[model samples]
Every structure is written in C-alpha cells, then in structure tokens.
Target: MAGDLVLLTGSTGFLGYIILTELLKHGYRVRAAVRSQTKAKRVLAGPSIKALAPTDEQLSFVTVPDMTAPGAYDDAVQGVTYIIHSASPIPSFGDGEPPAQDQLEESLVKQALKGALGMLESAHAKAGGSVRRVVMTSSTVAVVPFEVYMGQGTEPDRVWTSEDRIPVAPGPYGFEFQAYSAGKAAVLNASEEFVRTRGTAFDIVSITPSWIFGRDELVTDAGGMRAGSTNSVLLGVVLGVKNDAPYGGNAVYGPDVAKAHVLSLDPVVKGNQSFVLNSMMDWEDAIAIAKKYYPDAFAAGKLREDGKQPTMALKWDASKAKRQLGLELAPFDTMVKEVVGQYLELLAAEEGSK
Candidate 1:
C-alpha cells in the first residue's frame, strides 16, 4: 500500500492508532476519519504515533460526518485508494451484562457493515471507480466460539460448529466469544457477498485478532473505561496474580496485530492470503512474560486444573499470513511485556486522574 493514500475509519482507537502509526511508519499518507477531530489530536500524541506523522503535513483528520447516515464516506471517499475499516466496539475490563456489550451498540457490526457497503457504493459513484480494496478489522472470536472450545468433548452442554460453521439469524447461543466472533463472521459473510455480486472491483479481507494487549493512544473515556483495557481474564489474574491460574488464550502484541491488518490488505486473499496474526500461547508463557515485566499487573491465576494442557486445537493456521505478509511476530516475552507495561501505564494514569 505504499504511495497510496488510505482512508482509515477508526483512527482514534487503540488498534486504529497502532495501524495509523504503522501505515505512516511505512510512508502511507492517511486520512483519519473519526468522530471527534479534537480527541483525535490527543490520540496522535502517543510517542509511537507522533513518530509516524512527524508533522501533520500529509496527515489529515476529518470528523466522520454521519457514519450511519446514507453516505458517510461518500464525500470522504475522494483520492483514497484503500479503506482501512478498523473501527468496532470493544469493552473495558470486566464491564459486562449490558445490552450494548452484545456488540450491537459497541461493536456495531451491522451498522459498520452498512457503512462499509455504503462506502463501496460511494466509491463506485466516485468519478474514477470504487475503492480498490476494503480491509476490515475482525475479531478471532468470529473464527471460533468459546462455548464450543470450552465444551470440547466433556461439557455435554457444549455446542459444535455447523455445516457452514457460520452464524445464522437464529444462531447458536450468544456466549461472549461466540457472539463476538459471530458478529465478525457476519461482516465477512456480508463483505464476500457484496464483493462477489455487487462490487467485484473492490477487494476485501478480514483480520481477526485475539485478546489484544498493548500501549494505546486513545485516552480513557470520561467513564474511565476503554476497549482492550478491562480484560476480565487478565483482570481476574491481575486480581488474583497472587495465585496461580493456568490460563491460555490467543494473546498477541498490538503492533503485530496492526501489521497483520496492513499485510492482509495487500489484495491477495483470493490468492489464499490469510490475515490472522499471533500464534497460540499457553498460561506459562503469559505468566513468565507478566512476571518479568509486570509482576504487579499480571498474575498466574488458578485455572481449571485440567493438567494445564491445551484443551483443544488452540492453534490457528496463520501459515498464509506468514507466507503472504512475510511477518515475523514479536517474541512472547516482548509482546507480553509491552502489553503488561501498557496496562500498568493505564492503571497509573487512571489512579492519577482520580
């Protein structure tokens, strides 16, 4: 995507900030479409971000005018060769049980898709043609459901992937991972349909990420909660780091996740391209990294004493990403440290504000 001016929809988010920083690091000029240009300024102040923009000469910011309206990106679609649709709803640590937490309000998967589809429409209406590609931010929760994994073979209450392994309107129970992944799966399904029948000229790809932990440019909201901030599993451990909990979830570095998004958008999906970043990891790895860099922030919590063995196929086939993106993920030690360090920084900042 070099020499290309990409339009980013969620430039003020954690992953968005990292993605923008990465894009600018690679010399890709950006048009950050966010809700508040004012808040966008603070987000760009992160050391990592400031280093990318250097000066706001080529960088541009625009308040996404009516993203849910008829054609939000219609006028904003000028000169942008690529679209990085990275905005989505995420929850702070342990904040739960709200109707919004269901991804309808926070994730806004459907509305975002509508906006994305509208962009394709808006792009086609452009004088030249539709945007060349639309890169979406999907969650790993979409790839596999937690209930299925948790049930495995023993928890008779477990469910399994269906023939299509896709979600339907009357789909499986909406557990946390299931619902989140289901939302992403729905968007990808929609994207594929739109591209195949309506806008073949526009390429689309989905980058699914797991528990993302890293430094953030987006400040804590007025409520003091932010996506990727209040991780229940981590918090449970952080709350219980004093104890040992055998925990293993697909945790990756934020920067690596951002890099995966860029590489996935390289117009190579039909070419068997993949957008998955971060290989699977187990509890000990997270514990070691947490202990080294954030002894106070992380903990080795006491998990189900199922011998701490990998419950199921806790791996994802990221071979395509490696082959296509040629990306080398940061080491577990480095990635975990960066994530824990960020959590601590967030904790300190929150305490100071109080």
Candidate 2:
C-alpha cells in the first residue's frame, strides 16, 4: 500500500495540497495532475510540499490542461492504484461582478460534471485493471438541498447524513454558492450512477466535507493568509466582516477532511460508500476562542470581539466517518484556534517585517 501510485487532481488547490502532503506522509507515491507545469512547480515549491521533499518516484506531475476535455485523464490514470479527483471550479469572491447565468452553469455545473465523468471514464477504460478505488472530494452542500443550505424556507428538523441525496437544482442559479452546490450534487449523483451501472472494477468513495478551515501552509503573505481560502470565511468573523446571510454552522478541519480521503484508500474500508465529515460550529465562538488563547491581540485591537456573523446551525450525522475511517473529527474549538491562531501569527510576522 505504501508503494502504490495514486493519481491526484487539484494538487494546487487548498484541500488538494493538503491531500497531496497526507498521501506522501502515508508513503503513497503521488502522480499529481496539475493544469500546467507552472502550477506543479508552485506546488512543489510550497512550504508544506517542500518540507516533505518528495523525490521523482514519490511525487510526479502530469499536465491535464483541460479536465473537461475528452480523454483528459487517460494518460494520467495509467498504472495508478487510486484516483483522487479533487479538481473542481471554485466561485470567485472578488470585487468583480458575478458572471451571468450561462457562465455560472458552464463554469460550475457543466465543467464539474464533465471533469468527474471524464476521470472515471479514463480510469475505467485505461487503468481499470490497476485502479482499485477512486476517492472523490464532494461537499456537504451536495447532500444538503440549496433551499436548506440558503436557509430560505422551513429548515429540515432532521439531521443530514451521507445517505441523503438532493435532486439537482436547475439553473439560472441565483448566485455562485447555489450553482456550486448544484455542481457538487450533480457530480456525486452521476459518479455513483456510473459506477453502479458500468460495474467498473474500481469502487467509489465520496468524501463530503463542509466549510474546510485550517492553516494553509501554501499562503506566504498576510493578505494571502487573510483571504486566500475557505478559511477566509471564518477569518472574516474574527476580523469583524459581516456576511449578508449567515453561513451554516457546519465545518470540518482541513486535515481531518484530508485524512478521510487518504484513509478511504485502504482496501479494508468499504467501497461505493459516502462519508460525511463535519462538526457543528458557532460563528461567534471564534471570537471567544481567539480572546481566550490570545488576549493580547484583542487588547491591541488586532482581533475584534464585535463581529456580526450569525450562526445558522445545520445538524449533520458525522459519526459514520469516525467509526468507518477511524477519524476523530476536530471539535469547533480546535478549528477556531487553528484558523484564528494562524491569522494572528501571520499578522504578527507582517507587523514585525515592517
């Protein structure tokens, strides 16, 4: 198992880089699929990846410029024992205006579906004899309906689980989040269907995580640390940036989610199953956690206690991940400390530099 080769997509992304490091740490050889050689170089030069110092055999790169293109992964999947397809389009949260409905559908929904299906097709056709499993990176948004996640109508009284499935919401999606949610859900459903119907040699293990947050070692500067990742959504709370609508209080530590993906690769773990990874979190808890751990920051006005991010609790049954993957999901306190602690550390470094 340690020597087996794994094909990993999205090695340059937030969660993907963590997964890449975890795979190397576990002794699995990685063939990281990057969009370009530049991205591969960036990932290799990253602090976390450089720390591992993976050699050519231990880590390699294959450029698949367009994941949605036909036969995109045919060459990359060869001889690999597993495929971790984490590459997906993310919504832009910048100052620019949101894309039109067709653009959103093309970028978020269509691209996601095609990329996922194409990977599976390649593995099945080219590497079916070698590839034993595919651990896909899904999200809690896939399992939770758009209406429920947006807090639009009556909230479901029941706790959501990996077993739950939501019908794909048709576009003209109102915003990026909704379109992104639809994309994840579509990929999950389509992937399952493909495996179930095709009877491919390999099985699928879908990991559905929510609001992943933790130290992003790839981030080098203060500005990058402040707004570079999903951690930013949580960081915004500590910095007193308010969300127009409260984000659901569902989250999982980045490493824990990464662990889920890596652990699922073991043959002993059941195949063709979904795992929900999350911990219920309160938005305001970040302030308390920060103040309790770093009183000087709040005293110096570097961290605020007057943030207005409201918590919308969304219950999820995540016990299966712990029992099945033998993962102890980090509690909200741990998540808050890690995220806020990293921000403060970066801020201090920046201030010291000046």
- What is candidate 1's TM-score against the reference? 0.78
Model 2, 1-354: lDDT tens digits are: 788999999889889999999999999999999889999988998888888898999999999999999999999998999999999987765524566766898889999999999999999998857999999999999988888766787465888899999899998887889999999999999999999999799999999999998888777766776664788878878888877687898888899999999999999999999999998888888888888888998899988888878777888999998898899988888878887887888888989988
Clashing pairs in 2: none
The digit string of per-residue lDDT tens for model 1 on 157-233 reads 33222112355233343544434445566666676677777645566766766667665556443223223352334
Candidate 2: regions farther than 4 A off = 95-98
| TM agreement with the true structure for every prediction | 0.78, 0.96
Once superposed on the true structure, which residue ranges of model 1 sit more than 4 Å away at CA?
95-97, 100-109, 150-165, 169-178, 219-236, 241-248, 265-273, 294-313, 345-354
Candidate number of the best TM-score: 2
Name the lDDT value of residue 32 in candidate 2: 96
